[model samples]
Target: MLTFVAAVSTGFPAQAQNDRATTTVDYTVRVNDTLYDLASYYLTDPGCWTVLKKLNRVADPKHLQPNSTLRIPLALLKQSLLAARAIAVSGSVERTLGQGPFLPLNFDAALTEGDHVRTGPNSFATIQLSDGSHVTLHANTTILIKHLRATVLNGIVDRQFELNQGEVETKVTPLKPQDRYNIISPSVIAGVRGTEFRVVYGDGAGAGNTAVEVLEGKVAAQGPNAPPVLVPQQFGVISDSAGNVGAPIQMLPAPSLAEPGQVQKGLQIVFEIAAMPEARAYRATIATDAGFLHIVNEIRAESPRALFDDMPSGSYFVRLSAIDRNGIEGLSQIYSFRRARPSEASAAATRTANFEFRWTEDAHAGAGAGAQQTYRFVLATNSQLHDPMLDQTALAGTRLVLSDLKPGKYFWSVAAAVSPNNGESHEKPASIRSFTVGQ
Candidate 1:
């Protein structure tokens, strides 16, 4: 799932965070490389070569030893403030400039330091940083952009987000040496250099705590007063309200989907996965994009079946993952599906007609619109629909008329068969209705 975040509170201006420690990078001194050239390439000003020479003690700037590494303080590196561009915004995503009132956020919106963003239930937003990193905000999440700055010369970005509550998933680009990416929660800060990971706070088992799960690279989960815990790939760490980091918790593997969600014809969309022995819950996310950059809805259930509310007839993608015991999420797999509208029917017994059934169809029910729905009518004495009295298929019209029925209580159902014209056929039955015939 595209797990984004929410913040119950916003942070003060990033200027208040100036006390963050200064950092540096190691630059290799290549052959024929002069200090002036290095300064011109990596520093904001080439004149900073004097400072570089003094720091590296390179008496002879023109003839530096090859393969020798020089320490370059980030304070002197060419850097610039950065912003996150809202590439995909879906549902009720709200953004606030600083501490101002939040307005509806939209695509191509620029989010910078001190800005606060949040997603209402069933909403999602994906924002791209200046460094090619993407952060996907899942439903019911909020985050405060504490810092967004980068050393443009070396692709070293420093991103610090404060998660007051909720969760987020990020796909981070490889960072240069000395770069950092950190998500601060109530109790701990989950930090990574270059990785795809998930961070959650104020939810699940560890309410008011922080949980960090590493999907690809490693993450250093550290609490306020405790030491850092290394969580490698497919591992997780949790920090409590007291700022004590837990041991490295093993993440559950990605669960396999029971069936492909290629076509759905129902009032509700359901996706089921194979049950996991240790999974505390299952999480499913729906989006229009395969990258899950525009997550539209999300659901969590104790069972393997994940059902979403009725959606319009359109194509969508769903991501499925398991939440482990520590309230940490596991690896997820994404699948695509097409939803067809109004998989329902109504039945009646007219005075003259034995039984009349009519089913709803998509408004665009014609060629080229791709909404041609055929139906199957089933009649049985039992609600289980077994031992059918009459089973009919390939009924193209919306109205079906049946005569010469026996006198008894009978149950009937109509299933809409939708052919998406993509070589896939699906038959989804509506709720069964019953009628009593005169004895």
Candidate 2:
């Protein structure tokens, strides 16, 4: 049976109300329906069949199978030709698209002009524009996608975004001569072309300070009444809340990776950076995305490097920035990295009086020749390894031999340690093996 929600002149009734912030409505196919009919009713413009076809990738609008589903994109149905898409999201990120109420934003979600995006604490989102530019919103930030439009005939794209609060990182692609990308903060406007930059519009105590850091290419920052200031690579400017624009200052230099080419081992992915003068501390963020939509681990290290050990094995990116005494974070390049654990380990079968355990070695071990590995061996009678056990620590080498052991059934395992130091003590346990022994 086909279900229809009060067929009105605007086509079918919205089947499901998306509670979260989303721009598109889901519609189920019914009898005596054509793409043109659906578009005419819901979109109020039957001539938008081409846009609907492109949006839904429908080969034949006339042949929409019965009970088939379609997504009625409210953005395309609206007057705007371009929309911002959330390509990646993590944590509590939400958006308001078109007239739709705020809803939980997800990956690949599209937002129309005048849409708003807000991120909660520890939340992050990355949006991609039609021109291949990207904007990443950090935690506790709110931004409005004020305008996004493109003309197919002229191949011109014009975008405008407003950062209401907090920070955002932008990577703008090269645009056509007439194309434009503009970001407006509370006190200033930043215009860019084929550039990478970060903008911070403060809140609370930091209010009235709209800071712009140009990482690559250049950006033009201007106040409401002041002239534009050309900020080039590795430079920044701030517009105070009082409507006063400040002079450009040199941005903090990139901190060099201590061992950029080194493979990460053990549970902890350790990072070291060269010390920079006047650097009070270093902030490191690790993410799966190069743009760092959602950072998995973020830490502030007083030392030259940072260590992250709480994540699983996969390719990741590390971004390191310097923090001056005033808590201003400097610009840093994103570094690709991988966290790999030592190979799985196994123990010898059935042992009589003495038994030994061995495990694999990591190629990038230790300070030099090989990784410095310390092994911990455990021998227990039960698989649970509750009590009847001999726990040995600081066993140097791949194998450990235990003598004068009378056992019926014993379970043993080996663990590796990066060093003898007392920093973040977590046992990297290996696979356990059971053995039978006869006295």
Candidate 3:
């Protein structure tokens, strides 16, 4: 009777109950895999790597051991997926599921599911894929990501994505060797084992050429009737018209940074000089309506060099000139500058011997003008102002003081400088005023 009355009960364990309350998704680690790709594949969001790293307390995703288990929060993964699916189009609207107007020129667009992205005239859009891959669409480009998924095969999960495009930059970070991603262009097919690279298709008349730039990793570019090019910053230009494959050329270094001029008196001129393969020395010149003057004559030191400090406040044309090791000279585009008023000095007069000397700071010229400004005060025994002393008594700054008891008349003037504001005068202008320093 007691055996017949026995009852059987089925219940979950305490750990299972606690895990159910937390709501987690299980993921296994794979070879050559990173957290970025894993989070993107499982969570359907590229930015989820940040959250996954935080939740899992992973400092570095590169060292993830194969066959390790990861617990991902369902709520966080859902939020990330929604965010990734929402694309911002042209700073004017947000489009989800890829339904929107064509992307404008030089604009950006994001894609989730159901995105049939197309490019307008002279326009481009960059797509951040679900598996941490980036695809950039060149002008007149077309692309569609039909399916994205993570599947377990042989106890290993691999992320897969397919792309049909005009052009794209795919950066794949796979967890295992089995992870697969493919991009199919009009005339070329690209497959990534695990790497980062860019593929660009020409537009309009240039339709047949495909250019690929590898940033960090390697990629294989395959086309009909041609050997696969292992592009490593290596670009392959295939001619659609002739079916000829051109050799890959390394990209040139980007243009250097330049500063904008600010107007003080006329305009303050500031410029940066870039390094070239043959550049050896540099020289700068400034030309007023009166005449041309040398500003700088320095030996080449470094690239993207900076030239700043005070110069005379005046409206003058400025030019930076350079010389190569072969003595070949290159001139920069001519620019203009004007020094306003001397920020610290005003016009004044001083008397020497029995004559009166009137001197005023060139507010629009010299260091205060935001360019290098140097001043040299000269004292001559003749009024004709010829035969000046090579080592004549000179004064800098706004104030000039001359002393001598010579009774004969003397001529005096100032020469402004155009070098760095290191208080050294380089070139002098035609003396503006002539006065007797002594009677």
Candidate 4:
């Protein structure tokens, strides 16, 4: 009798087929039940909401019906879960169209037409397209992914990515030749193969230029009414209104060395001075290979002034040092600056007797040590520390306000003084700085 029952159970083909066709999962939404939580419960992954929306073409998740039939793909659900887990472990995606800002990826984020994506400084982003093509947006770049699709047949994949304003390095891994990826800028369109390349864009005088450098593999760039040019291990530039693509410019081998004071012209350099305890007067110097040296020309009141006019057109090295009331010296890190040709009227009309100062407490350094340092501020009309019109002292972190400074060159310095009762001395170093007042 046991053998007969086992034989009957083993021969039940119809029952097995019915079991295979039966549905094991069903989900119903409730009031206040978010898509994230619903996806987590039924699909075992919250990110499945994105896949579900894409699959069903549901315009909005917030308006989901209380009961809707959603046919979930087991394979897609699993893949979405894995991708979400990877993104959670790593940093979130930052989208850049060509060279733009780093846009943080939110849940269920979608890209549409005419959106510019940009990466931040020292950051990058990766996007997995529907067509299985992956785009990695490099740092300090902007790129646009215009269109994407997945198909085995001859389908239209018309993409127009523009490097609107910055630089981007792209690596395209395509599954088939029928799929097309087009990189467009204001001046050039590069039809790429499975390759790696970097594109940069910049604007000047109401027009933009694009530069394309091929790193590996080859790309064909087409210009208006011109034949295609093959770019391999070479770079080319496209300018406005010309509609003519320049010949490929081969990259030279890396320079073996650089000469001292050889700064690139037209590069802007910024200098910041660390706060000092008792320093007020500062002097800056610049030296170029052409034997040109001068002080900063553009002087602003908010911070330290630029000492010299646009540097003589040459590569230059710059240095800045500060002097205090007691004639103590403090120096800053040496940096490089290059100035283009001086423009007309770089100096504006000058104003007199307009200035202001304030003091704030220093939080980083411990306060009120056994020997407290007092700051004595001294202001004078001349660079020489004499004929001072305003003088004052305050506790550390106290802002000393001064205003109505005449529009002219002036010198200022600070000295540290200690209380005798605490056996503290006033012989510590001081600081000095100079600036001009403008109308």
- Cα-based RMSD of the predictions, in order? 15.9, 20.7, 25.0, 24.3
Candidate 3 lDDT, 284-383, residue by residue in tens: 4443321121122112333445344455544444445444343323334344433444452232122122222323333334354454334666666665
Distance (Å) between predicted and true CA of 176, model 2? 3.2
lDDT of 2 by residue, 1-439 (tens): 0110111111111322231114455678888778888777656467887777887788888878789878765444433367567767878999886668889998778777889999987678888775446788888889988768764323356677888998888877656554557777756566665677887888421566777777777765544445556677787776677656667678687686766655565557788889998888887877664335446566678889787755655556677888665545787755655455644111112222233333433222232345455667777888877784688887665455455555255676666554434655555435555543333
**TM-score of candidate 3 on Cα atoms, chains taken together:** 0.35
For model 4, the stretches where C-alpha displacement exceeds 4 angstroms are: 1-103, 106-115, 120-123, 128-140, 152-159, 203-207, 255-439
Supply the TM-score for candidate 1.
0.63
lDDT of 1 by residue, 1-439 (tens): 1111111111222421442324567888788999999888878888999988988898899999999999877778887788677877888999998889999998888899989999997788887876457787877889999879878666666788887778888876655555667677666566665678887777674677777788777765544344445678898877677767778888888776776623566678888789999998999877664445567788998999998888876556677889987788887765555567564222112123234454443222222354445678888989889999889987766566566565555677767665556777666435565544433
Sort every candidate by TM-score, greatest first.
1, 2, 3, 4
lDDT head-to-head 2 vs 3, winner? 2
**Highest TM-score: which candidate?**
1
User: Considering summed lDDT, which 10 consecutive residues are worst modelled in model 3?
Assistant: 1-10
Q: What are the clashing pairs of model 2?
A: 10-41, 20-103, 21-103, 208-241, 365-370, 365-371, 366-371, 366-372
lDDT of 4 at 57: 69
Q: Indicate the worst ten consecutive residues by lDDT in candidate 1.
A: 1-10
